[model samples]
Target: MNVCDYRKLSISMSYYLQLFRNNAGVGRTGTYIVLDAMLKQIQAKGVVNVFGFLLHIRNQRNFLVQTEEQYIFIHDALVEAIMSGETNLRMEQIQELKKSNSYLEQQYKNIIQFQAKDIHISAAMKQVNSIKNRGAIFPVNSYRVHLTPKPGEEGSDYINGTWLHGFRRLKDFIVTQHPMHHTVKDFWQMIWDHNVQTIVMLSSLDEINFAQFWPADDTTSIDSDSYRMRFLSKCNKSDYVTRDFIIQSTQHDYELSVKMLHYPSWPNLANANTIYDFIVDVHERASDYRNGPIVIVDR
Candidate 1:
């Protein structure tokens, strides 16, 4: 099972105890008091030990304990769990300390340069290269999975990305850049042609000075001349925004559903508490579409 499903199955013990905060129909003001108290306790005596106390109390007294004070206590316990998202910060620190740079050197030096030997490649594809964030940066061919061009298009049709080979597969995932305004058409075209089911967007549209390639919002739709994209539904969580899009090919008479999980928080020290939360959510959601290729975009 994916992490989200596993957490759902074990909600009582997970980091989302807010779901149980008002299960007993407690007053909003009282709940806030309890929540504030729980936060103070967490700040004073570390979250792990405080969480242990809450677990013990929950085990001793059932979730629906009697008395308003008891109810407040249980609610406070749940609040404690919700505020203990500090684990995200801790895990990031550990990862940064142990992160490897071998792949960075290998890709930047060897694999990425496999096809760039011909400097004329970028000049050949005027529009794509001219609009790229980084000039002269192109995906290598040998390991790069070429995106299929639309009918009638000839020669190289460039959309900057490469096939990342995993231990047992020829193509594990496709790593690409955040889409530019001019390349939005090509971006959706790539997804339509490749049958990409999941797209994990790591950068915020506002930060990149770029227009979003997807539909405007849950209430609206957008078009790429050949395809019409409409927002079907959207779920806004604490760490990420999951938007469901239905894309119809005007020329082909077929429609496809796509999940675009956008993680707007780029993880600065200020919002470290929820950084990994969106990443984990995307990972779990992407796993649901394992049958098809995933397109991952970053800044």
Candidate 2:
């Protein structure tokens, strides 16, 4: 078998640059992790099979593995290692690989290796799942958090959200995108339907591209077809602002106070310690409310 020339991996700058630019950030991180695997394959079988490797991440976050220009490339140094008949690939000792050709290599490297990803179970989670024939075993749709459909409206059940397992229950958390102007009403409907007690907002009300889903101040109130949200109080802190609201279901005879902790500039923490502290704070406040799914909104 002929040894692969690694430089053959490099394509024309115009083609490669545009691909990398389009698939920045999360795309970058996924590709490098897969590249690390590709290196090992080259050391053994002498081939790299993917142009881009990403987006198969769990939890229904996105479409799995969007690819472009399905092409296989070769690596030089690793292909030669088979001549010595050594099968184990020690990636760290590779001198040629030390040079970062792909800018995506460093993104989430430590977190990918060291982060705790296993699901945690609480007493409540077990209790909820123990209910006989809960229908969770056979989901009607793939959506994690299903919204109540508006009367006589098609596709009202659809929303850009997914349920996440938390310590409290199998579906204790709802992670969703920032609502656009059109979907803002549907957003409130889900909150009202599910009896969500706490919402964690990652973006500010004034931020670009994010619809102002809530009222700006304590004196303001926003009304929809099915619900009325009135500001109750505001607590300002260094890293976050807590806003309390009285949510009344206009259609149903029920009223509840929901608390929202908004992080205007999320993940702008000083260090890992600050990030950990922020998470702990959010969890603590969310637990202080009535038992319900905690809503986490994306920026």
Candidate 3:
């Protein structure tokens, strides 16, 4: 029988067998026995047909599996011969093909090396630019660090304390190094009031908690914008968050916004601290660009 017939028989056998077994005592005894026997025969035939079909499929796939390597080799040889353009029977044509192949191989290697060198140079340039920018803004004594809070927990003393202490030191250094137009508090207030693109709180490694520090009903205040107030929370192993939050926050807060910096379970926090310091330094130095969109770089 065809596959369709085999499937039909298989389904019928299963249904009849189940019904016969369940209703063995309730149904007429002789009728149940007969039906059970009929089901057994149908089941046997179905099993045989299914086995045959499986064997046929295995045989069909066997050829494809066995000859795959050979096919690949043949394809490669044909491609190489075509690329060499050595169809003619002449010995000179064969020699020319060999030379062409060598030239092509060398060209490929050169291209690869050139691309690698270009990438290395580009990376180095980025590093140099970052260093130059930071040097111009941050004083010698200013140091920055990152703080991440635990999931379901409000901002703790440890996280905020670490950040606050580090930033306070940085402000002191700046005051010592240069004559400031305003006190540190005044500087920070200016940043908060003018919507300065200075500090960025990225959602690295987890979904961050975001809330407004000021009164919720103060619509006239600049901080009324939900984007102006952002915080990050680190989650446990089973937790997850979305990238949409970052994008939406960026849109709402034209100056400072949050971002997700996905890091491996065992990550180096040193880089995060460095980035935070760089951002602060940049903003302190280039106060003119504080109104523009803040760019946060994360690895």
| Strongest candidate by lDDT | 1
Model 2 over residues 111-203: C-alpha lDDT tens digits? Answer: 244321112111113443222122223221233466787699655655656676676556788887777666777777788888898898887
For all candidates, the clash counts are 0, 0, 2
Using TM-score, rank the candidates from best to worst: 1, 2, 3
Candidate 2 clashing pairs, residues 3+ apart or interchain: none
TM-score of every model?
0.53, 0.51, 0.18
Q: Worst lDDT window (10 residues) for model 1? A: 1-10
lDDT of 1: 0.59
Candidate 2: Cα lDDT at 93: 51
As a TM-score, model 2 comes out at 0.51
Model 3 misplacement above 4 A:
1-108, 115-229, 237-261, 265-299
Q: Per-residue lDDT for 127 in model 3?
A: 42
Cα RMSD, model 1? 21.4
Range of the 10 consecutive residues with the lowest summed lDDT in candidate 2? 115-124
List runs of model 1 lying over 4 Å from the truth: 1-116, 119-133, 151-156, 218-220, 224-226, 251-253, 269-273
Clashing pairs in 1: none
Residue-level lDDT tens digits of model 3 in 134-189: 12332111122112323663321010011111232222211111112222222233
Q: Over all chains combined, what TM-score does candidate 1 have?
A: 0.53
Estimate, for each residue in 126-219, the C-alpha lDDT of model 1 and write its tens digit.
6635555455455654434455555776433667776665454446578887777776766777777777778888777673565577766767
